[model samples]
Target chain A: MVNRLIEPTSGRILIDGRDISKDDPIALRRRIGYVIQQTGLFPHQRIGENVAVVTRLLGWSRKRQRERTDELLTLVGLDPARYRDRYPSQLSGGERQRVGVARALAADPPVMLMDEPFGAVDPIVRERLQNEFLRLQEQLAKTILFVTHDIDEAIKMGDLVAVMQQGGELAQFGPPDEILARPATDFVARFVGADRGLKRLSLSRVGDLELQTAVTAHPGDDAEEARRRTLADPFRYLLLTDDDHRPIGWVDQDDIPRSGVLTEALAIPMSPLVSRRTTLKDALSMMLAADVVAGIVVDRTGRVLGLVTVESIAAAMRPPDRGVGAATDGSGPDAARRLAAELAARDDQELGRTEATRA
Target chain B: MEAFIGVFAWFADPANWQGPNGIPTRLLEHVVMSGVAIGIALLVAFPVGLYIGHTGRGAFLAVSLANIGRAVPSYAVLVIVFPLSIAVNRETGLFDIAFVGTLLAMILLAIPPIVTNTFAGMRGVDPDLVEAGRGMGMRGGQILSRIELPVALPVILAGMRTAAVQVVATATLGAVIGGGGLGRYIVQGIARFDYQRLVAGALMVALLAIATELFFSWLQRRAVSPGLSGRSVRAYENVAQLGRVDVPAV
Candidate 1:
């Protein structure tokens, strides 16, 4: 029987169209930057020297090393002028982590392996660092293999989340939303936690959902006209705004008179509103806080963009049923059983070795 | 204080540099003997201590034996080695007895600190750092040389400092065995009741010890970390300028 880990595994591990296993591990390792759990800064060296150490080892010129160090320091959000000469002991934990990242990015390797680099820091710093990394990844587009135990963090960070089970076995590999919505197995579901629907929103962006074009009614418009617009629309409330497009309140159909301006009848108090950039998670939180069915999505100028309803959110939360046979496809139960039996046989041999060592 | 100054003045006199029995020469010989003993002790201890530290087996035995060596007074070791040398000298009639005896005594005195410090330094290396080095594909030799030795260097140097001062102070024991250096002046001055010469010899040893310590301390600072060196002002300036960006978006 073939070893499950060393043999052809469940999923293909690729880097830039090349199989990770096919290449020389040494050459592959050089192309990939790895940052471990601890910030591996050499305490004896200056910050500039520490950042440049790997680049120097990689045979870069002294001039190129200096240039790359400065660029990465700036890229990791550290002012090169301030931190370049300091030792590791002098900097705060957050600063050291940024320096760690700068060191990893020094050679500009196409791939990065970060294993809980920010796990040791406080929550506030962790969040800021995570967001900063997100912004950096957006700019660099490096293929990142980030190993984190935090499911929320994995959902937020990974473009393709590969959930690892006990003994470093891959449990599931897919887009974050797909995994959160439709977990592959019982282990995957439990690992993702019971509140998988709420976790799904963290992966869903505002761009993914359809936005409602709100009916705009000026506060100075004729009351009957505003009433007509409100009555014509399925929504009972007409969004009342000033001439400058600043949202004032809503005009209910019942409160409008037959004629005259619609001012006093307008309810000045509005429900909670959130920015367009707000995650569906944040929008849901706002919706819950305001005890409202929907929230107004506004731009930076506070002009109304659209509405987010409970139906749209619920639709996103619902997991489309992918039956058990979805993975099996045309390869019948016989083939899957054969593969599992081969894996089990290999696992037995390894297990026997482990037991013998214990004895 | 007045008496010391007077003695210092008398010792400073150029005429006193000359002696009927070559007192100045004996004092210079004593200084050289002490320096040689300390250097040999360092050579003997550093490698043995490093090997014992790297290999876990027999480390406790080595360190405990070193402690026992330290506990046995230097004079006691000298006395023990002196009789053995007398036997060798009688048979061979070829060896310098005093030099051999003084070296044995000084080497025994220096090993304990080096062994204990090396063991502690090796154990004190950050386990994560070792794992990091290993994860980077460094083998045992490379890890010990590149990672372990460099990190343990400061502690090892500190141990050497202790050993140097200890050996230098203990070298005075050689004068009792008639081995040359300031100790000979000290011994002669005592026997002849020459207070000025004794004071001069003591002053020289004390000054030399202080100078050696200062020199090793500077070397230790340099060998360990450039930032920890006396030139920390520039490093501090660089640190102050490190992170002055706008508040990061959370």
Candidate 2:
């Protein structure tokens, strides 16, 4: 309806404030970018021409089209020199999808309509493309109405997700965290699946949480002092740090010798290393893998900042961003509340929260 | 071997090279008549094919015409137009009665392949490409010219190639209609029982037909973008150019 590919029998679609049904569909679509699963590249055209199709359509000069084509290809991580002259048949599925995105972005349209653009590639390639597109989205920030059948993809890609039922009826429209925390309908609740609370864990990042300061000791420091400090903290684990403050590993308080200097060999197995941008869900999963209470949060240089415990991840599960949506839902928020409370009560080694959060 | 020697000697005879009914005169006559017929066929079939192919309208008509063309023989069309040529120089600018009959027959014979192939090629273009073009705000004319035309060129040319070859081979019957062409050599050689001229005429027609096929192949390579035909062009040519060769009714 946005592009008016098929006219609606009822209802109007508005872009800014005006109904697009009244607007010239050709002109309206020109202001939007479009990408599809097949990539829909003109097989007769070169890669450079395919990327710059919209620019060429918009009457840009030949020189400008060439420059923009090269620029967009490079932005999408394809080397313009290598790929520009090749045909669509010459590129891989992933490369063709990138060109589809690049072509859509060619005219710098304010709105983008993407229909399962990454669905054609294998899972690993899809993940990489999704990450690359997300990074690019951070910079470009174009409004995208992405369509996908996979609910996991919806939860991952969309900031404001519109869950459509089987007949194109709007089931729910809200932010990913909100919908996950509190789905509008049973269809949506079922659509997001039983693991919606765990899915919501992906929404909040480690940087957003106030991490705990674990008891720290250098390799050459006194083991007695380190043991005392570890015993004092509620976590009861000494984080071994190097001279650069980069974490070595975790050390149990009982494992520390009475009066000897703390050596590098005294450290037990390492906890998973996490960065600030790491999702709370991933952080929790990583902590669960090592059967530890905490994940060491690191900076870009891999220097330890602080520790994110299970409690922080549980706290993030709450839907803090609802207005009218708080009243309509039945099971989502209540389930999330019970799971978060249950999670908050567990010990650091209680990584069995996954099996317990059935509600 | 003896018959082949006589044909070579016929070619070496300078007498066959001169005069209004000579080799050069007859060859020019053959090319002009066939060339004019092809031009007219193109003018008639090309637009109708594109219109039907692009709009997806009148497809039944194109299919029916193609089927009818395939079912009817070249001699049958020439026979059908045989009576029509004697009537009144129907439209002005027509020169000679046999030329009129043969030209009409050639034009009729040429229409179906050009129309069928053009329609097939145009419709063969992926609809996704057309949709993408429209979604990108390309106008109807722009889509047809820029996307559909370039992509469908090989198929369209293949149709033309078939039509041209068929017309060249069938033009041999123009000599039976009392018209001038390389066909005259075969007709006169047969009538005079001159084995050499008869073989020579058949060989010359065969050579012209081969040259037409190669010329179209080169033209297709030149006209179509390499990107489109980069890998499967040879395969596509084999598929589309099938059944084009017709044995002349000598």
Q: Which candidate is the best by DockQ?
A: 2
TM-score of each: 0.82, 0.87
Q: List model 2 lDDT by residue over A127-156, tens digit each.
A: 999999999999999989898866778888
State the DockQ of every prediction: 0.21, 0.49
TM-score winner:
2
- Looking at candidate 1 chain A, the ten consecutive residues that score lowest on lDDT are A1-10
lDDT (Cα atoms) of all candidates against the true structure: 0.73, 0.85
- Chain B TM-scores of the candidates: 0.83, 0.90
Tens-digit lDDT track of model 1 for A151-261:
778888888988766566577899988888778865576667657888888777665788866677886688887788888887777788777676777666787778998
Error of 2 at A328 (Å): 18
Q: What interface RMSD does every candidate have?
A: 4.9, 1.7
Off by more than 4 A, model 1:
A1-29, A167-169, A244-246, A322-359, B1-6, B9-15, B19-24, B52-58, B83-95, B134-146, B226-250
